[model samples]
Target: MAAMQNITVRGVALCDKKRAGNVHVELYEKDVLDPHDLLNDTHTNLQGEFKLYGEQDELGTIEPFIRLTHNCKAKPGCMRVGDYVVPTDKLGGVYDMTYVPLDIVVSGEGEQCI
Candidate 1:
């Protein structure tokens, strides 16, 4: 078995029209299924910030992305606001994605405020 290395991912979730807080963020290896593929998940802080940590044998094998869920209490379903792929090639031992903007428009009738 190959040795595992600690990898950290950090980013901020921002909404162009909203406060951008309380958004759910999930990190997953692209094309992998749930339970085993889910590396880390967390909600954005008051300032729309979050961090995730995981271990992998090689950084290249971990094709990670941030899935943002906003307006979770929608009557029909939760909105998958954005899916941002982290550029692993630009990553060192630690990856800092800086800020990921989630711009979702809540239109139509009975659209609840986030």
Candidate 2:
């Protein structure tokens, strides 16, 4: 069996067409059934950027995913938070996940938010 190699994933989060800072971002092994299986957790910076690092087999690869959560539109007695998922292909080697947008929307009483 080959030795384990280090892998790094990076990306950005955006909500409502703007940078989403302080959002909870988690990285998990693909196909994981438990939240406890999370590999790493990091929050976006003021510029909505984040990075995660892990290890995988040199001969093989590990599937990774990014989950993002934000509460940019929550209100009293109402829930307008946002949840997003980004499943990534096997990272056989070090690579950049690049910038990803998680556009969130808020609507109520049949009225659209502008």
Candidate 3:
């Protein structure tokens, strides 16, 4: 039988010491052979704070992670995307990211001008 697994994530996003509001954040279940499954998504509030809860039903463990997309510190027509992995043990509970900085450019991937 498939069991439902869930997780909660909360945090504030910042850029150059200022609140980065409206930042896009999404949770996903990683898949090796297919597209990753989106579990939950939200935009940071005006205060740059966000809390998200996501649930998935599966027969085995689900590998969860987060993806953040923002325009902080980007060029006039570009955006930045970053991905973070959630500890498997944190499933069925909360994972606090605390304060995250969006100004730091993601290495290698650079910025996407779309």
Model 2 spans > 4 angstroms off: 1-6, 32-36, 56-61, 72-90, 104-114
- Please report, as a residue range, the 10-residue window in candidate 3 with the lowest summed lDDT: 103-112
Taking all chains together, the TM-score of candidate 3 against the true structure is 0.90
lDDT of 2 by residue, 54-95 (tens): 664534455665556565554544323333333344454445
lDDT of each: 0.64, 0.59, 0.89
Shift in Å, residue 8, candidate 3: 0.5
* All candidates in order of lDDT, best leading: 3, 1, 2
Every candidate's CA RMSD: 5.8, 6.7, 1.6
Clashes of each: 0, 0, 0
Q: What is the Cα-based lDDT of residue 23 in candidate 1?
A: 84
Candidate 1 per-residue C-alpha lDDT over 7-51 given as tens digits, one digit per residue, 9 for 90 to 100: 577877766734468888777666544343667789989988888
lDDT by residue (tens digit), candidate 3, 1-114: 889999998899999999999999999998898899999999999999989899999878989988888998788888888887889999999999998888775554356895
Worst 10 residues of 2 by lDDT: 105-114
Worst 10 residues of 1 by lDDT: 105-114
